[model samples]
Target: MLIKSSKQVSRWRTPKRFPVSRNSGASPASRIEPGVSWPEPEGATRVQRFKVYRHDPESGKNPRIDTYAIDRDKCGPMLLDALIKIKNEIDPTLTFRRSCREGVCGSCAMNIDGTNWLACIRSLDEISEPSTVYPLNNMDVIKDLVGDQTHVLAQYQSITPWLRSKTPAPAGHERLQSPEERKRLDGDYECILCFCCTAGCPSHWWNGDRFLGPAILLQAHRWLVDSRDEATGERLDELEDPFKLYRCHTILNCTRTCPKGLNPGKKIAEIKLMIQQRRS
Candidate 1:
């Protein structure tokens, strides 16, 4: 898709500092991996306090943290599990969106203690201090932990997330390609569209209402790489606008915040390369 030029450029590209690495230059605790499970904190039988942000839009009330106390032992599970236990046993009004607790649905993405994570995937033991949970940054919060997904859904719709073809199929089975061809969009096809990338993005923070963020760019690139996609030119044209593609300054927030390890920054870069190669 071509981005229209009438859109204004944003100054969200300013640099900022990140926290120091805690594991001798290794990845952070919030990193996601299959078959990895988090244990309880080192030593604590006492109560654990959780500070979760609350939002009630109907009353025009400002968002604030509401505290909850749970037995530290039972809370050692995944944060999602703990939150569910707390709500079922303590307060039902504590609100958040989640499904497919196995981390596939991408509904549980949130800012936990200043980082984005799918609560079902993050172990409570990994959090070192009293923690705070909030909706993803820079999005309209619909409730305590649910941000408005309208922009995100619109971007997905913009890409037409399914396969499209302009030619009629042959008289046999569909066209086939080598394994290598299928791998062209390997990691990108796994995207769950959780908005973690956009949430971490400073550009999205400033231009979310206008620009299509990394997540959208990644999806665009995914289709661009698909061997079966028929409208590559049309897709590239849609992204030509300033807010649609050029807004990305390679800040890498989308890469860092993704719970599924999908690199939207890398995808955008690849899309740029494809665009350049097509021009050449």
Candidate 2:
């Protein structure tokens, strides 16, 4: 085959018409950015070590901890800040899930300093000891610091996680809740489903499939206690199985490890009480 000239090939390969969208015309339409990163933080003299767990299922290798150095002054105070810095500057391959860096999203749950917490909230400067971060323990890692949230998410979906009331409210208004009725949802509403409570649970780790676990049980109580929602019996029916609800052996790890200060154990105890009362 005859080869084309260099100029002909270059003209043939270069894109000619980049049709711009009307909405995105004012903004840069191209998603690709140059391989550029911020230089090491200025005025940041102190360096802190982060032992981050690294894994790649595609590589066919065992997991290992990779050390990364971060300039304390250069990074934000939270552990997530440092992790993001590492990902953005040092290694773009480093991966973890994070949203709403204020800890409200619960997406950054991981084992930091031997405790389960939302990395966005855990302050790096608060702990004087050296730090090691791992994905939520006992979870199958899809990548570094990303646990398979399917189990907890499936259990959460099993709860249906919404009001299932059949009773219709007045024509012009929605179902109104009283102060007392709304108070019942206080502790349960705070759960962000970051998997910290379930991940910290030893019983959950052992029987995660059978056990509904703390986070699911917590949502169960959220509905069971809602006075405005008239689905208590159904909620209890969904959770009354011996393995599903009773497996929470009051280990209290769910409460102790909850970053939101909500007691999932106590709320679980409340669900047990509801089941017992229904039987009585």
TM-score of each: 0.81, 0.81
Q: Given candidate 2, what's the lDDT at residue 176?
A: 88
Candidate 1 ranges beyond 4 A from true positions:
1-44
Quantify how close model 1 is to the true structure by its C-alpha RMSD in Å. 11.1
lDDT of 2: 0.78
Q: Can you write out model 1's per-residue Cα lDDT over 1-280, one digit (the tens) per residue?
A: 3322211112232222256542233234222122211233445576566777777677565565667767767654888987897778777877899999988999998987776778898877665346667788777777778888887889779878777888787677986767998999887889898887788788987888777898888888888889888888888888887888988999886776778877788889988887898888
Q: For model 1, what is the C-alpha lDDT against the true structure?
A: 0.75
lDDT of 2 by residue, 172-240 (tens): 987888998898799889888888889988889788888988988998889888877887788888888
